[model samples]
Every structure is written in C-alpha cells, then in structure tokens.
Target: MFKKLVVGTLATGIVLTGGIGSASASTEGVENTKQVAPIAQKIKLETNYSSTNNQYGFTYTWDSNRQVYKTYDFYRHDGVFASYFESEGIKWYFKGKVRDLPGGGALGHYEGKK
Candidate 1:
C-alpha cells in the first residue's frame, strides 16, 4: 500500500539522518580532544621564584616539546592570587584570594588548575 511505503520511507530517512548526526558529533569530539590533548597531558612547571619582599612574585616556564607557556603568580597578602597559561590552541586560567595569616603566615583557600 502507498501508506505503508510512505511510512517505511520516512522511517528510513529518520534513521539515516540520526546516524549521520551522531557520526558528525563523534568526529567533532575527537577533533576537540586532539586539539587540547597536548596541553592537558604534557604541561609541566619549569621554574618558580618568589620576591624577596614576598609581596609579589611569579613562576614562568614553557613546555619545550609541547610548546606550552605557563606562569604562576604569588602574593604576600594573597597567596597564589592568579595563574595563566596557554598552548596548542588552548588556554587555562586560575584565580583566587588568600589572606596572610598573623605572624608571617598565610591562611586562605584557592581552587583552579595549577
């Protein structure tokens, strides 16, 4: 019957379109993983230093093999106030506040990728 044939054709179209959409989405995820994989897997801290005054300082370095740049900043009143890095078409950021404790100490909380 024409109705049966039409129903079958519509079902076939829907299935084909769904399959194509899923395939494309999977491919896109793979591409994104590849783009960010280098930085996520290979980045490492190279050097870190603090200021003599302890008010402000920073660590700077790069992953030579992966070509990722990284830096971490330190603050006397605010421990590890901010951090930033980028590589392989991806960028990462971290920021928080920390209070310097009494008697030359620090007390605070921070959260982010380090």
Candidate 2:
C-alpha cells in the first residue's frame, strides 16, 4: 500500500509540474494540459437550462415590465472560467470562484455581469 501511494504521488507531481510548467505555451496546449492535469473548477450558478429556455430564452423581470440577459466571463486563468448574467436593465455580479486543490476534481465559480 505504501509503495502504491508513493508511486501515485510521484506520478501526480510529475504530471502537474510538467503540464503546469508548459501551460502558457499556447491556448490549445493549455486546454490539453487542463484536461490532463487535475485542475479544479467550481460553478456557482445552476445551469439547468431546458429546451424551452434555450429556444425561447429565459426571462428575468428586473423592473415592473421584464427583461433578460446572460453571459460567460473569464480572466484567462490556467483552468478557471466564469459565467455572467443580466436581467433586462438589472445587472448581476459573480458568485464564487473555485481553486484547484491538491487532490483531484475541478471546482469553479459562476461569475455574472451586466
């Protein structure tokens, strides 16, 4: 068990160091590295978009009338991205962000803006 754990740790370190070291070479390469490396991403918003929402789009009533808008925003992080949202004249802000842990999995935050 100890041998297995050591081997796994060593392997993970090698891959992370290698990929992260070269992540800035190119955009395509960065994406590939993100897939290989154990990057974390945490999406704050709920993305349960139905077919109707996609087709007709969802509505947000900011004022008495009604309005709706949404968007995706990011600051070009290694493996992190954010989402934006807007409701008619009303504006929204980012919720939370996710950072890569030492273990595995991806956790990201959904950021929003007008």
Candidate 3:
C-alpha cells in the first residue's frame, strides 16, 4: 500500500509538473480552501486530450459522482482549473490536497468554478 501510494504520488507529480503549470499558469481563479475535508469520489473519467506519461496534458471529462478514486494531491501545488476537467454539467477545478490509492481509489476535494 505504501509503495503504491508513493509510486502514485510520484507519477501524479510528474503529470502535474509541466502540464498543470503551463495549462493555467497560476491558480488565478481558484480559492485555496484547505478547510474542506476531501471526500471519496469515483468520477467516471474520460480523456479530454491525448497525453503521454511524463509529458502530460491535464484535461479530462469527469462525472460528478463524489465517491472517490484516489486523491488530487498533484493538483494541489499549482491548483487545477476548469479546463483541466469538466464535471457536474459545469466546468470543475481543484486547489486543495488529494490522493489516489491502489485498490481504494481517488479521494479529492474540489471547488466548482464561481
């Protein structure tokens, strides 16, 4: 479990490094709300754009089923924007901590676009 978490974290970090920074530049519109506790959300996700492993493009179509998959830890640093993922019939974004585990899945805390 620890190994998986570590690997997942590293992978996610790589994904976010270039893609996320270049995507939005800064978490401009996103609020750094660290108060909300992350909830499990197994959102049905689809690729929004084609991205390779290390060279990632953080864009995806996600369902709003708030069950949890892993975590959005990678998204926390730069903060993800609506262009990154779409959910709940509206564009979605995240600026808090999140994570993804092997069997359990992703656990994320997101803030919808205002």
Q: Which candidate is the best by TM-score?
A: 1
Off by over 4 Å in 1: 1-57, 80-92, 95-114
lDDT of 1 at 16: 81
Candidate 2 runs further than 4 Å off: 1-47, 50-92, 101-107, 111-114
Model 2 Cα lDDT, one tens digit per residue, 9-97: 98898797786566555564454555565678974554432221233243222221222223222223354433444444334554444
- 1-114: candidate 1 lDDT, tens digit per residue: 999999999889879888645655445345456554434566565553322212223343454444544443333453433355443343545544445666664433322222
Encode model 3's per-residue lDDT on 54-84: one tens digit a residue. 3222333233454232223333233333334
**Cα lDDT for residue 114, model 2?**
38
Could you tell me how far off, in angstroms, the CA of residue 82 lies in candidate 3 after the best superposition? Answer: 9.2
For each candidate in the order shown, give its overall lDDT on alpha carbons. Answer: 0.46, 0.43, 0.46
lDDT of 1 at 100: 68
Cα-based lDDT at residue 29, candidate 1: 42
Q: TM-score of model 3 relative to the true fold?
A: 0.21
- Clashes found in each candidate (C-alpha, N, C closer than 3 A): 0, 13, 19
Candidate 3's clash total is 19
